[model samples]
Target chain A: EAGVAQSPRYKIIEKRQSVAFWCNPISGHATLYWYQQILGQGPKLLIQFQNNGVVDDSQLPKDRFSAERLKGVDSTLKIQPAKLEDSAVYLCASSSQGMTEAFFGQGTRLTVV
Target chain B: DQQVKQNSPSLSVQEGRISILNCDYTNSMFDYFLWYKKYPAEGPTFLISISSIKDKNEDGRFTVFLNKSAKHLSLHIVPSQPGDSAVYFCAAIWSNDYKLSFGAGTTVTVRA
Candidate 1:
């Protein structure tokens, strides 16, 4: 079985520019999550989706960040007017329904200058 | 207001020694705890976990102990090997939701 897959392993953008990252989760996994990991810090949950429906997004910056899991298999996370603080690794993970363990993808490293 | 914290930024241990990593959380509602290991430029991989109801969970050489009353947890790796060197993160999930809150990771170096 394949693990979660993500595109554009690294990205560099200027402040005020927009950036997007894509994720394809493991087959049969119903729970998908996006997380932001800053240098020297642990990953922080940005949003979570369960079968195309958002389960939680309390930490997401509504004004600048948005994500969608259309069709419930692949997902995309976007950030507009990126700030310096937004430079971090964006990780995508998936888990089986009601499962505690999450399988993660190689993250997209975004650098906003 | 960081809900989870890993006070030690790094630890160094000789190969065959024990490596203990600590974590503490402020949210009492968190019932599920997990540990993840990550190498440079890679996403974190699930390591071991312990639920709130259990005081300890062991898997091979990895053991996790949870202290619900103190809202603290620790991971112990016995007979550490050079291959075990990596950044370890402690994460918690609230009982009401699946969202995971994580602490700053601790980098462990098991030197030969």
Candidate 2:
């Protein structure tokens, strides 16, 4: 079975510029998640979607970051006015159910200069 | 506040030796625990998991042990291989919530 897929394995953007990352989860998985991993740290949950409906996004930065899972299959995460602190690897993962083990994608490494 | 903690940032062990990585969590509500392995430039992959009801779970050469009373859990790799050298993260989830809280991650180097 194919694993989760993401686009633009690497991205470089200037501070204050806008950037977007895409994710396509595994087939038949209903739960999707977005996470940010800064250097030397573990992935921090940014948002979660269960079939196009948000399950949790308490950690998301509403002032600069937003994400959506249209039709519940593919999802996109966007950051506007990016800052140097936003430089990190954005990882996408999916699971068959909310409580099950998740499979992850290669991730999009965003470098904000 | 960082709820999950992996105090050891890195560890080095010889191949064929046992590698033990430790994690501690402060949240009492966390009922499920998991371990994930990540390679450079790659996302973390699930390695093993244990539920609150159980103390241990094993898969191949990897074993996860949970000590609920101590709010600590550990991942043990026996006869470590060079391929096993990577960052390992420990995560915990509440019983009613699917959101996982993760540790800072521990990098393990299996020297040949």
Alpha-carbon RMSD of each model:
1.1, 0.9
Q: Which stretches of candidate 1 lie over 4 Å from their true place?
A: none
Backbone clash pairs for candidate 1 read none
Q: Write the per-residue lDDT of candidate 1 for residues A1-109, one digit (tens) a residue.
A: 9999999999999999999999999999999999999998889899999999999998999999999999999999999989999999999999988787888999999
Using lDDT as the measure, the top candidate is 1
Candidate 2 chain B, poorest ten consecutive residues by summed lDDT: B92-101
Alpha-carbon lDDT of model 2: 0.94
| Candidate 1 CAPRI grade | medium
TM-score of chain A of each: 0.99, 0.98
**Per-residue lDDT for B1-112 in model 1, tens only?**
6899999999999999999999999999888999999999999999999999999999999999999999999999998999999999999987566778889999999999
Predicted candidate 2 versus true structure: per-residue lDDT over A1-113, tens digit per residue: 99999998999999999999999999999989999999999889999899999999999999999999999999999999899999999999998875658889999999999
Question: Every model's DockQ, to 2 decimals?
Answer: 0.76, 0.75
Model 2, B43-93: lDDT tens digits are: 899999999899999999999999999999999999899999999999988
